[model samples]
Target: MGAVMGTALGAVRVVGGRLGLPVDDLAVLKDGSNLLVHLRPAAVVARVGAVTASVRGDVFGHFARADELSRFLAGRGVPVVAPVAAPVREGGWVVALAEHVPHQAERTLDSTTFAALLRELHQELAHFTGDLPARGPLDDIDAVLALLSRPADLVAERDAVAAGWPELPVQALHGDAHPHNVLFTAGGPVWNDFEDAWRGPVGWDVACAADSRLLDRAAVQRAYPAELLDHWIGVRRLLVRCWVAATDRYRAAPPSPSPSP
Candidate 1:
C-alpha cells in the first residue's frame, strides 16, 4: 500500500477495533476523498478519511451526520443505502460504518430508471427538515481551482457562474449526483455518497446527472429550462474535472502528516 492508503487503513483498523466492529478482514472498496473498506465477517463497511477538518466546513455536519440524512430519506421511503452504525471520529479521521451493499459495479443504469430515481431523490430532499451545512458548488471552487496548474480558463468560467447566480432558483440537492454515484443493487437502485448534500440550484444536480450521459438530455431539460440546464452542465462539468484533478494531485503529492495521537 502507498503511504496515504497505508496510514488510512491503519487508522480504520484502530478506530474499528475501538468501536468493537470487525476490522480483521478489511479490504479496500475505493480510495479517493475517503477510503471505503469492507470489514469481513461483519455486515459493516467503513468509510475513513473522507472528511478532513478543513473540508468539514463544506460538508453537512461531520462524517457521522450522513446517517441523519440516510434515516431521514429512508423513513420517507427513499432508497438510499442504509447506515448500519454510528460514525467514529478519532485521531483527526472520521469513519462511518454502514451496510455493505452488494451491487453490479459494471451494470449500466437504464435511462428511464435514472430519470425516475433523480425525480424521486429531489422530491424527498425537498422535505428533509434536518440541519445540514448550507452549501453550493461555488463555495469550494477556489479550493478546487487552486489544484490545477493552469486554472485561468476555469477561473473565467467560474466568474461567469458567480455573476449569473442571482437569477437561479435554490433548493436542497444531492451535490454530487453523477451517474456513478447511483448503485444498482438487488434491492433496486440506491443512491450512494451524501457527503455533498447541500442547498443549491437544483439544476446543479440535474446537470451532473446529464453529464454522466446516462439520462436523456431532453428528459432532464423537462425539469430545467434548456438554457439553464446547458449553463449548469458546463459549470458541473468543470467542477467535476477540477475535483478529479485535485484528487489525483493530492494522491500524487508527498504523504500527509500522520494522524495526531
Candidate 2:
C-alpha cells in the first residue's frame, strides 16, 4: 500500500476503534484524490483525505460541510449517502464516516435518467441555505497553477477562462457532479462525495455531468442552456488539466523535513 493510503488506513482504524466499530477487514474501496476504506462488518465507510488535503487548504472544513449537507439532503428525502457520524480529525488526517451503501457493480444509468436525477438534485440543492464558496472548482485553478510554477501558456489560458466567467444565477451546487460520484444502488442512484460542494452557477454541475462519455451529451445538453454548458465544459477541462499537473507535482516532491522535538 502507498504511504498516503497506509496513513489513512491507520487513521481510520484508530477512529473505528474509538467508535467501537470493527476494522479487522478494513478494505480500500477507492484510492484517488481521497482514500475510501470500507469499515467492514459495520456498514460504515471512512473517507480519508489523501492528495485532496494537499490541494485544498481547508480540508477539514470541506469534509464538515459535506457531512452537514449530506445530512440535510438525506432529511429532505434526496437519494444521498448519509454520514454515519461527525467528521473526525485523527492522526493528522481528516476522516468522515458514512453509511456503507451497497450498490450495483455493473449497472449504468441512461443519459436521460442521469440528467433527470441531476436536475432533481439541483432542485433540492437550491433550498440549501448553508454557507458555501461562491466560486466552485474553477477557483482552485489558481492554486494548481501555482503548484505547477505557473507555466506561461497555462497561465494565459487560465486568465482567459476567468475573464469569460459569466454572471449567471447561482445556487448551492454539487460541485463534482460526475458519473463516478453517483452510485447505482438497489434503492436507485445515491449521490456521494460532497466535499467539493459550493455555491455557483448551475452550469458548473451540468458541465460536470455532461463531460462523461457514459452519458449522451445531447440528452444532457437538452436539460440546460447549450451556451452556458459549453462554456463551463471548457472551463472544467482546464481545471482537470491543472489538477492532473498539480497531482503529479505533489507526488514527485520530496517529503518535508521533520521539525525539532
User: lDDT for every model?
Assistant: 0.71, 0.83
Which structure among the candidates has the greatest TM-score? 2
| Candidate 2 lDDT by residue in tens digits, 1-261 | 767557678889999999999988999988777778999889999998766777777778889989989999999999899898888788788888999989986777887788888889989999999999877776688877776778998899888888898988889999998887798987789998999999988888888889987887888878654458888988989888887877786677723312212
Off by over 4 Å in 2: 254-261
Estimate TM-scores for all models.
0.87, 0.93
What is the alpha-carbon lDDT of model 2 when measured against the actual structure? 0.83
Q: lDDT tens digits, residues 1-261, model 1?
A: 786667767777887787788878888988767778998878778887542333334232555457777878889888888898677655656667788888989885765566567877888899876665564576566667754545788899888877876465566677888778888888778888776677767777777777776677776556444337777887777677667766666656734644554
TM-score of 2: 0.93
Evaluate model 1: give its TM-score: 0.87
Q: Which pairs, if any, clash in model 1?
A: none
